[model samples]
Target: MTINIIDHFNEYFEMVPAISDELKLEVYKLRYQVYCIENLFLNPGHYPDNLEVDDFDPQSVHYLIRHRKSGEYAATTRLILPGTDNPEKLFPLELYCEIDNSGVMQPINREHLGEVSRFCVSKEFKKRKNETHTLAAIGPDQQDYFTSDERRAFPLISLALIACVIKVSHENDIRYLYATMERSLLQFLSALGINFIKIGPQGDYHGPRWPTVIKITDLLDCVAEKKPNIWNFLTNEGSFGQTRPIEKPSKAVRSNSWVGT
Candidate 1:
């Protein structure tokens, strides 16, 4: 039987145009679930209650999915515009990243560039893989967990977000795309056909680290082959984004935010 990927995906709302209180609480809850419950990042606070949310929250565009039946925030993510307001253009390293801001070369051209960060799934959606380790599939409900289906979904969402980010950049009259990331995720992105330039390293454990200069047009070109499947959400159980347990998460740096479903 054919599967409709988006069908399992809950209702999503962009946290831009306006900020609803319900939206705010949902996003914070997702943050608490992932950052606090899943990956305790030492800096504990009641802010997100489950995950982490810093000053960046105010400056970024938020995205969320909710249960149509319950209207609960299921999954959440935020995008940081390269320049304008967002420090990513200037520092690339996210909130936790620290550098001599005066000495660092800030990002340029607010138009085409943006950083994707703080992605999280609500804890209610997260599920544990088998003891041996494997991926999870989209079940009846929820959004925050890194199930096997999401592993497949992340790249697709990243690609779509990249496209949207660029499209928005064009509308905003900006050019050039840039974001700092890890060597491993960059490798995975490269396998999916994204070509990026290294911008050298920057930041603390909670900040942006080994950075890569991602050329958006070039990335689109490499991934163009799977455009239809990706754009159409042709994702399935055996997709490239299969979810797996983080046996040694510290070994490989993950840029996407967390949400345990």
Candidate 2:
């Protein structure tokens, strides 16, 4: 049976905005598991509470992909928006890697820029033998949740995270996104028409990572042309086709704005 990727994804997983403190903690804990314990890309000692967090988190919007059946958060990602108080503040990529100013990076608007950071999937969700050591490989135990055909759609988790990034960025009026990504991940995304331009040479950060950038409009256009299904999934049926600026909320209102499932 040919699976409808979007329907299959929605049936088994949920894209939740980590808007509340409790949900944000869930995002941090998942990051701690992936970054600190599993990958050792970060030192567990640095996060005594076992929650992986950083300075940019204060200016970021977090999202989690939850496995509906198990009620476990299978993956998490964050979009680090520009600082409200200091729009000129440097992103992590700026501090860690040298960006190429000669080409596509020259016209970036700082006020509308955001970075995709700490994107990871829990080990339990990674399903292939070769992917065991990577950030998103699934375990044998998770196999019971799906039939063989359904299992083929497992890679949607990564796409779902990208969808989250697109949604949040649109809501916040963010146009450009920066990320330091592994080559394999970049290739995977590129194949799906989600191209991110390499703006700098590879740098050693947790591992060899290439600094990249993508304009949200350009990405959407590419995906829509080459892979309409994926574009539909990412844009939620064209809802994010236009920028919809979300009003600034008071601290209290923001805290109560969303509840993750």
Candidate 3:
């Protein structure tokens, strides 16, 4: 049976913006699970409240993917909007790695840049042997929480998260994106025709992560040309390519307290 991957994804999962405090909590809780408890990327004890949060959370937009049947959020990701008050504020990657000054990213407008970070999936959804507990090995699990088709659609979660990032960017009129990802994840994205240019040397933080950047238009172009199905799934079928422009926040809302997911 041919799987309509898009339908499979939509049937089982929904991607939503963390616009409210309740929704934001969902994002924080999931990050705590993946980054703190499960992976030990961050100290679990550091988050005494069981919610993983940091300085960047205050200036980021977040999204969570919920499993419709189980009502469990399976994955989460965030895009850190650039600082408006202080242009010199550093992105997580910039703080950890040396960005190349002489490159395609030099001319990009800072106001239009955002960083993609804090991507994670739940441990229960990781169901394959030797699968690195990442997107590469999402399959049916013994728990019966996911249907066979849902299991098959696991890899799409990563793509869907990227779609969310792109959606947030398009709505906000963002032009550039910075990210730090494992080389394996980068290669996987490449296989799906989502490409990024390395902007700095690989760093050891959270394992081997490469600092990379991409223009929003260039990313869209790559998807449109090399993976039309994915492009349609992201831009047309999902929440990313909505026609409504994101409303500009009022000055009061730009404060750190009002920002974050």
Rate residue 246 of model 1 by lDDT: 21
State the lDDT of candidate 2 residue by residue for 1-261, as single tens digits.
644566667767778899889999999999999999988999999999999989989899999988877899989999999999999999999999877754887798899999999988987777666565666443333445466644765788888888889888988999999999886688788888888988889998777898999998989888877887677667665666644322221232113212342
- Candidate 3, residues 1-261, lDDT tens digits: the string is 644556667777778789999999999999998888777888988999999999999889899888777889888899999887985688998898877744677698888999999877787677655444453233333344457777777888887788788878877778899888886678878876778888878887666788889887777777667876676566643335433222221222122111243
lDDT of each: 0.44, 0.79, 0.74
* Global CA lDDT computed for model 2: 0.79
Error of 1 at 233 (Å): 4.8
TM-score rank, highest first?
2, 3, 1
Query: Which scores greater on TM-score, model 2 or model 3?
Result: 2
Say which candidate scores most in TM-score: 2
Per residue, candidate 1 scores C-alpha lDDT tens digits across 106-218 of: 64444555666554444444443321110111233333455555444433333333433443443444345546554444655566666666555554443334544554445
lDDT of 1: 0.44
State candidate 3's TM-score.
Answer: 0.85
Write down the worst ten-residue block by lDDT for model 3. 249-258
Least well predicted 10-residue stretch by lDDT in candidate 2: 249-258
List residue ranges in candidate 3 displaced over 4 A.
132-145, 237-261
Q: What is the lDDT of residue 141 in candidate 2?
A: 39
Ranking by lDDT: 2, 3, 1
| Residue 163 in candidate 3, Cα distance off native in Å | 0.9
